[model samples]
Target: MNKKGWWLMLLIAICGIQTVRAQGETPTDAKATPETLSLYKNLLKLQHEGMMFGHQDDLAYGIGWVYEEGRSDVKDACGDYPAVYGWELGHLELGDAYSLDSVHFDKIQGWIKTVYERGGVNTISWHLRNPLTGETSWDTSSKEVVRSILPGGEKHALFLTYLDRLADFLNQLKAEDGSFIPVLFRPFHEHTGSWFWWGKDLCTVDEYKALWRFIVDYLQKEKSIHHVLYTYSTDRFETEAEYFERYPGDDVVDILAFDLYDRGAGYSEALKYCASVVTAEAKKRSKIAAVSETGGPIAQNTEWWTKTVLPSLRPYDLSYVLVWRNPWQPASHGAFAPYKNSPDSEDFVRFYNDRKTLFQKEVSKLKLYE
Candidate 1:
């Protein structure tokens, strides 16, 4: 071959390697399905585009509404659905028909399938009960709870049964073509806070890491369920070191995320700082980053969406930011995203129109799983 031809082939080979590397790191599960891998790659690419918007329990129930077809608070407020949808599996461990939020497990299954079919992303968080006390996740009266669920502990065997129930539900998430739908499974989240049983004050660093690794191994290796992308998230932290204090190794986590709410006057500054930290760490590790959970009372601040939330998040390369759920009762103050004709609804529409944000109509064209 000529010298020029030989050099051309070498350049082509180098470009191919760089292209693959740009798709981001392989998921922690070595045996992850093809769709899951593609989803990860597309999510990484999305960071350069814009942050996708997400809502918790968007399709299940909204303020003054429940089980309504083709209805969503986000869509009603902004004229489009969010790019990502969040679901909870709190009571699945106890073989319950409904979640802790009173949404039926069967209804969740249907909603997940609908989101998948519409080319949207789905993320699941577990607020499981404390196995030792048989109380809610917030009942952190005992610090020994984490140790009891570890290997050789008194509740070790029973914990395995809980894992079995979780694996069963995950394994059944199939599309119309029988292909498994990829989900971002975020278990034991917000460990930096002492609110849950697995919080930092309730367990040693080693115990928390062990619990995370055990769940990943059990679901991927033992149960052969490989359609999930594991996400690790914290509540709030002032520094990168504080964020990773309880983080499991990269081998067991796919996305690096943090959860912060709009509490008071310093919310925007704090949110910006946390977003910068998470995006930098994710870039160094070649992983996806996001605000896994965020939002507060929109009624209090009429300009919260455009002035506070948008400016805080616009500077980062994060993949998505999800607001909490809007309850069914009108008197409830837990509503995060604005509902139809709410005080902040106009501001939310302006936020939606920003080029730096991507909603359902925009994200669907990305074909993330393909």
Candidate 2:
């Protein structure tokens, strides 16, 4: 579709209140690229969006640390609702195998394998420090480990080193055919904002583009990491073109996504902005979009979040709308935590319960696993 065609279709999609009505028929029988088909298959599963709950370790990895290990809390929280069960892997840790020896490595591998076996979607996001300024080292291990085992470089070299090390680990973890267990891998996320060292505000677009292309090229050609789907995610950009401008193109990305958080401030507006941006991008690129990560302080936006934000995300090609953390707090509003005080443990429960039917219907329509 041309840009004009995409805009017209987007206008109709937004103005039209009947979201249940599917958009005009496209050529379903025509062969779609693996990325295209995978996105569509996942979108169909999105009717079950509530199945995926979001967790962030930087704020509260405690819950995620337990849940990923098969603790009862994950099941207890999501028992009634089928979910994607999302978690983020650290950037440097991507190079560090969770286990060193073969037996221990297998255990870590087994955890990941089981999650995929259960249709769990894992997104590994990493933090890259600029090695030029004498930055960049592994967080989990000693400097020697990063120096001896990890790849290092200056400028774009730092970013490429992380990617190269990760690609190697992914190779070891994959099946003999090189197909990864189906998990969503999102690298270089939140680029529109500057909180991270790699964010656009910190680095020039040309530099970001170079780093992005290098990672994608090395993965697809040199490493032949075909099973891994690369997603380009940004924070809520200030303008439409701001969002579109950062899109690296379909060649480098399989899924398009964003992460947003609210502390009861502009809850409705944030969702509206996201809905507009995601729908436009999805149509333009012929790709799937997701509110890959979001949630409010369980205390702050309990009512609005469960009612407004969660339900509103259903209309678009939103496959995974996840809750940030299990607990609540005032200070939690930053990234993962919405606040410091726990007001409602049941906030998530309410969201899960309220949206259960919608999720079930979406999942049933998509037949996600197949």
Each candidate's lDDT (Cα)? 0.89, 0.51
Report the C-alpha displacement of residue 134, candidate 1, in angstroms: 0.3
Residue 150, candidate 2: Cα error in Å is 17
Q: Compared with the true structure, what per-residue lDDT tens digits does model 1 show for residues 312-366? A: 8888999999999998965445689988999999999888888778888877765
Poorest 10 consecutive residues by lDDT, candidate 2? 141-150
RMSD of each: 6.8, 9.3
For candidate 2, give the lDDT of residue 369: 36
Q: On residues 74-114, what C-alpha lDDT tens digit does candidate 2 reach at each position?
A: 23443432344444444343355442211133444555555
TM-score of each: 0.93, 0.69
- Model 1 worst lDDT window (10 residues): 10-19
Give the residue spans of candidate 2 off by over 4 A: 1-40, 44-69, 72-74, 78-82, 91-108, 134-160, 175-179, 325-347, 354-369
